[model samples]
Structures are given as structure tokens and as C-alpha cells.
Target: MPKPLFGMAVAFGLLLVILLTAMGSFALFDRLDPPPLDKLSDLSVEVIDRDGALLRAYTNKAGQWRLGIDLDQIDPEFIEILLTYEDKRFSSHGGIDARAILRASWQLLSNGRIISGASTISMQLARLLEPRQKRTFKAKFWQMLRALQLEARMSKREILTAYLTLAPYGGNLEGIRAASLAYFAKEPKELSLGEAALLVALPQSPEARRPDIAPRRALAARNKVLERMATAGIMPQSEVMRATSKPLAAVRHAMPQLAAHASDRLTRENPGALVLETNLDRALQEKMEAVLRDASSKLAADLSVALILADGKSGEILAEVGSPDYLSVARAGWIDMTRRQRSPGSALKPFIYGLAFEEGLIREQTRITDSPVDFGGYQPKNFDMGYQGDVTIRDALLMSLNVPAVALLDAVGPARLMERLKRANVSVTMPEGSDVGLAIGLGGLGITLRDLTQLYTGFVNGGYVKTLRDSPAEASALAQATSNMGAPILDRDAIWHITNILKDAAPPQGAAKMAIAYKTGTSYGYRDAWSVGFDGRYVIGVWVGKADNSAVPGITGRSAAAPILYDAFARSGLTLAPFAKPPLGVQEQDFADLPPTLKQFKLAGLWASPSPVPEEAPRISYPPDGARIELSRTALGRQMPLIVKLQNGRPPFRWLGNGRVFAANGRRRSISWTPDGQGQSTLTVIDAAGRADSVSVFLQMPPSAP
Candidate 1:
């Protein structure tokens, strides 16, 4: 080199030494403190319906509404505006923009204050991952170093995704998805020009310019973004003007809470799941919820309702409403009534008839006596206290006569009826220290609404009951497992007989008699009223009652729950699927055309003798002599009726309450009597033979009674 060249060589050696030392220091810093990539994995758990509609979402463990996002899930126009306003040369930048940094430094020196920031999207993301409390030169330098490391380990799209996911948007909300959903009530896949502009402005000063907290600041910031887009030629001037004219959202909306109970259960079962996809139909769920709310509103106070709509063949739960109003404290709405067990009343009658048919002990046309009958000491009577002397098995089941059901249950042992239900995976809870008895056919045992609905699936699914499932993936797995290990709950012929009789059942008021087979059940004292029905493709079960197991004065399965079932089928938006055709060897016959053996359900020594025992006097079985009774009141402060029962009572009976005639002539053993007032009273019942039984009791009123 020349003299000038010697000086140039010395300067060049110093420059090269500085560059080598800087590169070595950068590498050492990167290796010692890598970008915290694992922070990106902490995202909000989401629960969605069948069509990918959000049902519910939960915040992260840190109480931040951080949701995962992807580049493709955002509108292209929003992305363009974001990149143009944040970093003009973002696509070509290598973690840090040297030209922008130089311009910022010159502007700071000239102005004596910082006017603009030179932070790229990558640097912003680095700061978000490891947030610094103070904005100093050392913090900025560290963020720049972390940005470089992030660029080396991840692609540009991945970096953008992480930025969008972790970006703050006022309050606890983070990410474009959370902000979009809260402010716009929609996804970011398709945002309006104004909406996109608002979202682009939020992350810069999330707290100060929150649309919900400070609408004017948010609007000014959004207009600034739109004006910049117009100046940069990213958006047309006309579009910018239109977007600026639009107002910002002043409040954040609540997240989707459709199928709250179902979503809550799914999240609890799968705690680690980031997203849960269920088989529920969002539209159907909304419709059913509205129906239940409307119906429950008309009911007595503190009474709630539950409904479930499922595919009978596939067992996919399309809609599940745990209560009419899940937040109502009076209704005990927090409890999931569909999973709670209660008495089924006569709802289990069809299954008992099916068991009898399967054992060749009865036929649909078989004449079964519905008259009063006493099995040892357990006497059963009809619901209305009036019974048809002799009726066909179909009539007995359709009418839900208690005596006939008990007779059939007695014919095909209650244990076997229980076993058949258990074979279909139906769980029944018998009373403590009690064996299966004839009264079980008349709501003697406890069973959940879910299990009862499952048992009814066999009638529609050709005698095979499927396991009900709400989650799509879990349903598929369970379906596969059930297919391999399941057996028919009833034979094909037996199911056909049961379905044929129930299909002719009368519909509730205002419901079109579609080709649906349904059965209604009213538990003892009306504690629980249930109606379960199945069309060609779907099975719907409705439960209406008090969650505390208190009685409703006039609630019945046919009146309270069946109307909801019929309305659900109408609003389901699904075409009524036709019932299955009769299976082979199944035929409809009249009573006289049947063989001698199948003409009637015969049980040796089971029928009561015609002669009455003079030694046994009529006795009041319930509210035993010298007892106290607690009765609930109606919503209007009217007292509910008290049911008085009698045993060993002959043909007609007379009931008197406190010397007042309650009933002049009653044929049944069970009578309903409303006391004159809540106090001590004597109830007297006289049989046809003039034999009398009396019970003295005190009626207690509820706490709120006046």
C-alpha cells in the first residue's frame, strides 16, 4: 500500500477487528439468552359446536384472554394496512431496520425528543414475550438481540403469527382473535375497513385507546391509521373517508356461552385441551334453549326445565339444555338436572311391556286386567283411581295404567326388567335395602333422564341402544367401541310391538301428530315430570320439575314436558324422520285372533281374590296416624294438594278432611285433598262396607308463607 494506502490499511484493520468482535459478542449473547418460544403455547381454551362456531372460551392461567392466531385466519386487507403503517419495508427487513433506526436517531437529535419508534414487528413480539417494565436503551437493545434470535429460529409467517397472538388489546384481551370477538362479535377472517383499522390501532396504546374505556381516543387513533393508509396509497381516499366516518365500538361483548353446561363439562373432562369440537348444533341449541326458557317461565316459581335432543342411531347429542336459566338461584340452576336421577313414574312401562313380549308372555293385543290388584302387601292402582276392567296390552301401555304395568312387571320379574336395562348400559338406583319390586314399573326406583333417554333409543334403533356422546371425536371412538361390545336391549319383534303401540300415542296440545313415538311419566306426588319421544332420526327427552325435589301442584308429564318436546321437534329445523318398518315375524292382530296362550298375561296365584277379607279393615297407608306432613305452595301463594292413600279399601270410598266432604264418591284408593288451612286436621276415609280409617296430621307451610 502507498502512504495514503498505509493509513487506509491501518483504518481497514481496525474496522474489521471491531466487526469480528461485535459478531462474536452477538453470538454469545444469543446463546446465553434465547427467545422464549414456549410462551407462545399458552393460549385460551376454546369450545366449539359441530360447525366450528364458538360455544365458550376460557382465559389462560394468567387471567389473560390470549388466543392463538394464524396469518391465514386474518383478512388480507388488515394485514396489508398493519405492515404498511408499522414497518414499510417489513418483508425485506432482517430483524432490525438500519435505515429507520438512523432516521429515528437523526430526528431525535434534531427535535431534542423521540418522535417515532423504529421497532419492527419482530422486536415488538420479543418485548411481548418478555415484557420489560421500563422502556430504556438497554431494554431496547436486548429486545433487538432477541428479535434476531427469533428471526434465525422461525420463519416470517411464524413470527407474524406469534406477534398477532400475543399482542395486547385492552383489559385482559390479547391477540387479534380475542379483540375481534369481544369488540366486533366476529372472527378476524372478514373485518370491515373501519373494524380492521380499529384493531390495527389498538395494540399500539391498548390501555389509553381502548374502545370500551376511551372511545374518543380509540376513534382518533383508528382515524389516524385510516389517514396513513390513504396517504401511503394502501387504501383509496374514498374508502379511508368512509372508514373514518364509522364509529368505534363503545363496549366489549360477552363471549359465546351456548350449551354452557355441556361446554363446562367438556372443559372439565379435558383440562389440557386448547379447543373442543362437539357434535352439538349451534342453531338447534339456541332454538331449544329459547323454547325451554319460554316454557319454564310459564311454570311455577322455582321450577326449572331440561331438554336433550340426540340422534337416535348415532347417539350424537345435538342439543343439551341443562336448565331454562342457568344463572337463576331460585331454580337451583347450577345443578345439571339431566344427569340427576329421579322417579320415572310410568315412563318405564313400555320397557316392562317389551320384556313381557320378548318372553312370549304377552302380545300387543293380549288382554291384561287393569283392575285393582294387591301383590302381597304392595297394592298398585291406576293414576286416576279409575281403571278399565279389561283392556289390550297396547291400551294399557298407551294409557299408562299403573296396575297393568305392575302386572307385566310381575310376570317378567322386576329383576329381569332391571337386568335388561342394565344390559343396555342404563343405570338404575334402587331404594336402599329394597329388592326390585312390582312398584318399580310405576316409578318405584330412581333413574336419570339421560339413562331413560338412552333406554328409549332401542325402540328407534331396531332394539340396539347407542351410547350418547356430545364430543365428536369421543363419540366416534365410543361408537366404535360400542359397536364391538354392545348387545340389543330387546329383541327386534319385541321392540316393534312397543314402537307400534307408542307411535299411536296422542300428541300434546297444539302439536301436530307426526310419526313420533313418545311416552310421558309423572313421578309420585309430581316431583319430576318427564316426556321422552323419538322420531325416525332423533330422540328428545324433556324434564320439568323443581331441582330440590319439591312437588309442583299441577305439573304432569303430558302437560308440562310433552309440550316442550313437541315444540322442540317443530323448531329443530330437521325434517321429521320416518319410523322404522316392522321387523320380520312381527304382525298386528286383534284380541280374538291371538292364540289361547298369548291371549292374556297369565300369572299363577298373582290375581287378587274376588271375596274381601272381613278381618282386614281399611287403613290409611300414607300420612300414618299421628304424623306430620309438609306441603309446598304454588307461585301465587295457593296451597298444593295432599295425596291421601288407603289400603284394603273396597270398591267405592268416601274421603273427608276436617269434617268437610272432600269426595262424595271415589272408586280409587288414592285421593287428592287440599286442606282448608295449614294446621292440625283429621282425614277420614270410609270403604264401601262402611269400615273407616282416620289419620290426624299437622300441615306445615313453607318458610315464605304469609
Candidate 2:
């Protein structure tokens, strides 16, 4: 019995010693001295340029921020309102207020659960200072202890300031300043009474308080704060009532969120940078976001969109929308779909034309037959379903005809065109035997908005492809713009001509002036819609489609994406920089004799009809040259012949013209042929010596005119 009692006594003594030691150690370490402001976390700030002005702010990985209000743009009333409702003893307390804590503790104990919060401004600041952790009881105790220590070390004003600067309001928005600007479209200091109250109510529940989500709840919370302020005598009762009666109107403005993303991206791309200077106009940025949001909501198809604005001269990205939502669920822990890959649709046509121009396979006015063509089981058709017999390269591209482009592609060879696109950073891996035709011209390759923007730079910057740079200074410092500095990929003249045609392709709609050149691309099955265009100084590309590549039923680029571009330009106030100047040593020509390929199919009227020979009775006046050519006369019978006058030439020259297969038999040059149609055809005369001339002679029907 005595031993058991002694054992109990020893255990009690050990427990007492341990308790005393822990209490002493905590007392010694818990009262922390205040830290200097300079010792605060390494916070960074981003100042964005917008519409000839600056929008200064900062963001975290979660996209939270502190606006420029604490620098005093925010009203003192807002700060006062928040302190009164959130922490009545903000001025008198350090990091923790004992009275509030006790009251909260009593309420929790009495109710058998916690329904009330008693975090002082200082305690909130302590939470902000530390990394995010679970809200466990132990963590709360640590937080409270730390708050007390912070109070012992810092002044009341310092704690309050830190709390105001670091509090998380919602999304990536932190602190009163950021919340004010993001919601009110004004500085915190510029907030009215009702606006101030609305902001004070958000920290408790950001989404619930978000004007976009719950305006009535937000208004009720604002009124609650106003009533508290009036009861505390901080504001007059009449003033509180007036503010309460006024609607709470703090809508989450979309522009700053987009700017934040752009600013953050620019900063990350160029770290340790003094300033992330960009060409983005803030007003324009806001306008673009607004237009996209409105348009997205109204669109019949359930889809998201991505828009990129760049400086045509410098290749600097002015603005970009990675996702529609400020805090998009799809963007979490995944590649930004805006930066992800999408089928380029017809957005790639200009570059294909650029390749043709470079290869000298087609010229602006080269004539091409706009007829149905089938190559090794491959076929292509026009969008209109009716092909133009003949058109110019400029007309075909402007009108976006498919048959002509396919014809040109076949002539120029797809292998060469693929190589050119690869050089432009476009990945074209269509299998080797696939008939490369106008199908390629209509955007059959996968592409990204960034890649498309870069390719367009050649058009805007005098046929020179330059790497995208982060800043204007770097772009300005690039070597003098030259044509094909790496290799001659495109003819300087061709780029010049193509840019001109695209620039005048269509009239600008809405308030936007037709000061830029652009193209619309629609993918097969209506899966992707794109509009890429450029003013003198900037290039803008927009894409709208589903993440799953599902067809939009009947939407096209011209119908959807073009309107977005027009809206952006009008809202951003973008003006024409200047016309793309032509390069030196580049001459304009009639493009005569250029082959009928995808890029040159528009020029198809140059070949004239061939003279036909009357049956076996027809006579020839000169020695025949060996060659095949289309004759103006059409055969109406099984055997048709016409008179031919061929100049002296060698044998074995194939006369290929007028869509017929013809060859020289001997000195007569006239050969009997079965005709598909009895009309004039394009004629050509060739000799083995490769020097034969011909005349257009009429061929009489063989006693039958069917």
C-alpha cells in the first residue's frame, strides 16, 4: 500500500515538473518582439500599362492581391467600417483582443459548438503571415499565441496595417485594397459608403458576397455593417439608413483579373525585371474581357474562348485570356487551354499561300482551272459547292475558295509546302501520300494561337520571321528587318501582295474601323473558329471552340471569331500603325504563265482555246512537232481533226493543253482525236527541239454536229 502511494506521488511530481518546464519555455518563447516592416515577406508588385495609364497591383500563386488602396487611394471610411464590424478594438489591441476572445469562448461553450468567430485584426494578420495550414484546434491555439506574441512585439497600427494588406477576400484576391478595385472599379479610397460596407462583408464569404453570384446577400451584409457602424456612433443613423437603402453594387470587374494574369505571365517570363512593360491598354483589356464574357454567355454553343493581342512590329504579347473565369476550374493544376493546342482551321491559308509565293509556283494572277479534281483517291471541294471557272490568286484567297487552293497545292507539291510551314514553326505532319491540295489551305493542320500569331509576324514585319520577345526594348534592338534572314522562305513581293489582299478581305463591323487586315478560319465539322488579323502595329488572334473538339453544329470563324476581333479593336481603341511596306528588289508583275496551283488558281483565264482539225479530210501546211496541247476546238465525233501550222522543231514534244492528250504523229502534226466536248480549248504547240509555234485554225465537224 505504501509503495503504491509512493509510486503515485512520483508520477504526480514528474507530471508537475514537465508542466512547469513547458509553461516556462512557452512563456519565454511566446512573447515575440515585433518584426520590422522591412523584414516582411518578400512581396512583389506588378504595375500594368493600360490605355496610356498604369494599374498598380500585386498577386500570389493563388492569384490573390492587394490593391493600391492602402497607399491611400482607398477611402478611410472603408477601413473604418471593416474595423468596426470585424475588430472593434483594432486601435487598442496588438494582435489579439482578450475581450472578444472571451466572449467567443463563452458563446462556444454555452452553445456546445462554435458558431461565432473572435479573430482580432492582429490574429488575422498572424494567419496571413504564415503559410496556409489546416484550421485545427491546435493550429488555432498556435495562431492565437502567435497573435499575442505579435501584439507584444508590434504596435497596434502595424498589426492593423499588415492585416489589411494580407487578408484573403476571395479567389486570388487578398486585402481590402485588391477587393475594392476588383469589385468597385475604383480605388478603395474612392469607395462610397455602400461600397465600403459591401467590401467589409466579403471576407466572411467571398463567393456568397460576390455581386455576380449573390447581390442580395451581399447587400444584406453591407446593411448589417452599416447598422453596426451607426450603432457604434462611427456613422450617423441617417447615413447608415441611406447607405443601406442604396443597392450594393460591387460587381467583380473582369479586366483586372485578366491584367493580373498577363502581368504575372510577363513577370515570370522575365524575372528580376525592373518593370514588365507591355503594349496592353488597360481600358482595352477591360473592354475585351467584358465583350468576351457577354458574348460567351450569349453564344448558343457551350464553349470557351481564348484571345491574344500582340504588337505586330515587336511580337510582344499585349493581352491574353487563358480562361474565361477569373478562377477557372479547368485551369487548376493543368495546362492553360488558352495556351493549349487547337486545330488551326483556315487560319493557316495565308501561310500556305506564302509558301507558294516563296516557291514561285504560283503568282497573284496565275490562271487555274476551278474544276473537280481527284488524285490517287483524294478529292477536295469548295465551300460554296459551285466552282468559279477562272479567278485570280488575290480573288481566290479573298473569297476563300477551296477548289482553287487544292489545284495550286497539287501543282506546287505538298512536300515543299510542308517544309515551308515547318520553318514557320507550324507542325504539319500529314502522311506522305496524302494529296496535298486546297484542303491544306483550308486549315487541316493542328496549331496554337501563339504559333499563328508568330507566323503572321512575317506578313506584318516585311516577310521576316522574328522570335517573340517579352519586352519592347528587346524587339526594338533586333537586327534590321530583313527578308528571310535565316532562309528565303517566301518571296518578299508575295508576302506584300498577300498582306494587301487579306487587309482588304472584308469590311470591319461594329465601331471598329477597317484599319487592319485579317483572315477567318473554320475547321471541318465546325469544330474550331478562328480570326487572326493585324493592324499596322499589332496582330490579334481569337479562337472559340469546345475543349473536347466537338462540332458547333453550324458555326464558322467568320460568323463567330470575326465579331470578337472587331469588338476588341473597337473597345481597345487600336489604330492603324501603317501599311506593311514592300521589300526592296520586289517587283509587281502580271503573274502571266504562272502554274495553276492552290495559291495561283485565281488566274485561270490566260490559256486560250485550241484550233481543231477536221476528220481525216483535214490538211496540215507545215511539218508537225511532237507535243500535246489543249486545242480551242472540241470534238463532236469519234474522230476529230483540224488544220495545224507548226514551226520547225524536233520530235517527241508532247503537246499538252486545253485539257486534252495530243501528240505529233509525223510531219502533219494533226492527229485524229475523240472529243469530250465540241467547244474551243486551250492550245499549245511543242517541238522535240522545244521550239514550236502554232496558229488557231478552225476544225469542221465530221459531217455530224451533235
Q: RMSD per prediction, one decimal?
A: 6.6, 17.0
Best by lDDT: 1
CA deviation > 4 Å runs, candidate 1: 1-24, 473-485, 609-706
TM-scores of the candidates are 0.82, 0.54
Model 1 residue 387 CA deviation (Å) reads 1.7
lDDT of 1: 0.82
Residue 297 in model 1: lDDT: 56
How does residue 453 of candidate 1 score in lDDT?
Answer: 87
lDDT of 2: 0.62
lDDT (10s digit) by residue, model 1, range 1-706: 5655555455456445533554566788878877787668889988888898788888898898888777887899999989988977778987877667766765665567898888999999999999999999779877777877888888989989999999999999999999999999999997999999889999999999999999999999999999999999988999899888877779899877788888888889887899999999888999999888777655665888898898888888889999888888889888889899999988999888888888988888888777767687777867665566788888889888888888878878888888788778767898889888887889989998887888887877888888777887765665556532577888889988898999999886546787788999999987999999998778999998999999875577876788788888887888888888888767898878899988877655856834544646778887788777766543222354666666775767888888877754376665657788778999998878899989899887655411
How does each model score on lDDT? 0.82, 0.62
Model 2 lDDT tens row, 540-578: 888877766778644567656777777777667777688
